[model samples]
Target: MSRTFDDTRRWVRFGTDLMLRSVGGLDDDAFAASSALPGWSRAHVAAHVAANAEALSNLVHWAATGEPTPMYASPERRAADIEQGRALPSGELTAWLRRSADALEAGMTALGEERWSARVVTAQGRTVPATEIPWLRSREVCVHAVDLATGATLADLPPDFLTALCDDAVAKRATAPGPALTLRAPTAVWELPGDGEPAVVTGELHDIAAYLTGRPAAPLTVDGAPAPALGAWL
Candidate 1:
């Protein structure tokens, strides 16, 4: 089923709420602790998420005003912003996260129905409608909450969100060179890369989502063999 803007908005709220809860109790030292994502601390993940909300709000503004506002001045600037913000005290970082999320939602709500259809470019250079912004935010908040490593897990995500994530992950992996693989979850089956004799990977929906998104794959199993290493997927 196609997702409506309302559906995406609800998911975005849920995901962001979860993210806030995940990091709410972190102290400054805890924020500096390594996150599940390799080489990134909890602070880094939190900074990236906050900056992402602002970057996406820029798209909403572009759509609303018909101005060409890029998400960042440049990739270097984007990295620099994250580095600058990542060292903030835990309380300030948390406040920044909340404010950025609220600002993005307000920017979206301010758009007229017609404005929602206006084309906008993502940081990745893909052109999409303004309606896509919520889905993009949903993906970031939900997945990164787990990366925060503050007791959140893939299973904590909403089922429908996990399904949507699997679909998106498969689509992104379609053009990458990899062995054809079938991801089997209780709720759905996805064919990855769509060619050749497919290797079967079995897991719960959350496990598959984690594995496909470059997270740990310990919970997933290949059909009577070791799971093949997947190549880089963003």
Candidate 2:
């Protein structure tokens, strides 16, 4: 079933709330402690979460005002902002993030659930209806929350979220060829058809996510393929 804006809002809220409560209680030093996502402290990952929200908010304004929106004025600027912001002291950084999240959610909800049908330009330069906003928002919040690894395992994700993520990954991976990758779940498997010579892997959904999003996983093969590259696109 296609998820509605309300559905999206519900899932997004659930995911972000879970993440904040799960990790928000960490002390200042603990906030800087390591978790998933190589080389990025928890603070770093949190910064990206908030920064992206604000960036998307700006796009919402562009959509409402008829201003042209580009994915990134330039990738470099986007990267620079994250790199700098991620280093702020834990207390200040976390507060900034909470502020960003509140503002973003308030702004989005202000548009009214019915308003998502209005056209908005995407970061990718595609013009899609506002209905897509929640999907995009869900992706960033849910996946990145996992990236943060806040002591929460993939098992904590709701069923619909996991299924939706894996299914969407399958469709998006169809045309792209790279390293052969396989996603094995406790109950089922998702096979990605890599370039001409398909590569394969087998692991649980969380394992699949871990590998795709630059986290470590079991001995999944990558023979003549860089299957993990596809994760970057999402």
Candidate 3:
């Protein structure tokens, strides 16, 4: 099925809710349980997503108000801010995430399709129409949510979302080297490792997403550079 950006946003909201639901059943200790990713607790991941939503909401507000805002106007300042907030209690983190999502939702809903096309600048100095914020926001939450071990794989995400992100990650390897990711597919022999047996990335698109994001060993082969790239992406 085809999807407009708004459609992507709706699905993103649903996916975030899914991740949140998984965490809801867990206690404080479990919330802080170590997931597959090193240096991040489940609560830390949750707080990061929630805090990001709040940050994105602020940009949306700036756009609505006709004030100056860049994609991440304070790119350098953001890391410190999120790190500080991620240390908050689990209860507070959950509340903050929900609040951030609600605030962004209200702002985006009020703007509707009409303003999505309106031009706005991001902290990185790129100017894009406001309509794409949800795409950005979705990328942050949906992907990071998996890191929390909430049990939802990227396979659970919408198909288009999965493919686009994977392809994007692959293509990015050429120019950005965002992470060393190996894509194991049916037709060709794809191996990122220069050495070692090829571990193929197995399963559906979402599984590829989760495995790529550092969750579990994708039923794929790993030999060389891609293995290190995994850590970079994580």
Candidate 4:
């Protein structure tokens, strides 16, 4: 089923709520512990997610007011912000994340339909309509919640959200120079960068999404072989 704008909006809300719950449950020690990502702690993950919300909020404001607002001042500054966020006290970090997320939600909700059509630039330099803001945030919160290593997993995500995530991952790989692979999910089929005789990988939908998104994936096979190693999802 194709997701509507409203569906994406609800997904943002749901994903954010789940992330908050997972982050909130972490004690100071747990928050300092390493996360799923190598070399980054849970604090780093939370900080990046929080910083992302504020960055996306800049896009929403640009769309609403017709002002040119870039997602971040610069790549270096963005990285620095996340790095700095890691040092924040646990209480302050959580409050920063919650407050920024709330501000973004409010900004998006207040935007008119016409404003939603305004074009904005992503941090990656891609130009897209403001309508993409929710989906962008949805992917961030949902995926990062699992990255927090607070017991949230791909299983907690909605099927539609997983499908959308897979669709996005596959689409991204298709446009770039990557290995040729065919992903067969229970409900859908996706062809990654390849011409012919691609490795056919079969798995449950969430597993496929996890593998594509650089998360821990369940058992999957590539042409009856072990799962192929994938580059970072970007």
Per-model CA lDDT versus the true structure? 0.89, 0.69, 0.64, 0.89
TM-score of 1: 0.96
RMSD of each: 1.4, 3.8, 4.6, 1.5
Off by over 4 Å in 3: 1-3, 70-77, 123-125, 177-203, 211-215, 219-234
| TM-score on alpha carbons, each prediction | 0.96, 0.79, 0.75, 0.96
Model 1, 177: alpha-carbon shift in Å? 0.9
Candidates 2 and 3 compared: the better one by TM-score is: 2
Ranking by lDDT: 1, 4, 2, 3
Tens digit per residue, CA lDDT, model 1, 101-126? 99998988888999999999998899
- Candidate 4: stretches off by over 4 Å: none
Worst 10 residues of 3 by lDDT: 186-195
lDDT of 2: 0.69
Native-structure RMSD, model 3 = 4.6
Assess the local accuracy of residue 22 in candidate 3 as a C-alpha lDDT between 0 and 100.
Answer: 63
The sequence of per-residue lDDT tens digits that candidate 4 reaches over residues 143-230 is: 9998988898888899999998988888887776667888898898888876546778899888899989988886466646766788
The true-versus-predicted C-alpha distance at residue 175 of model 4, in Å, is: 1.3
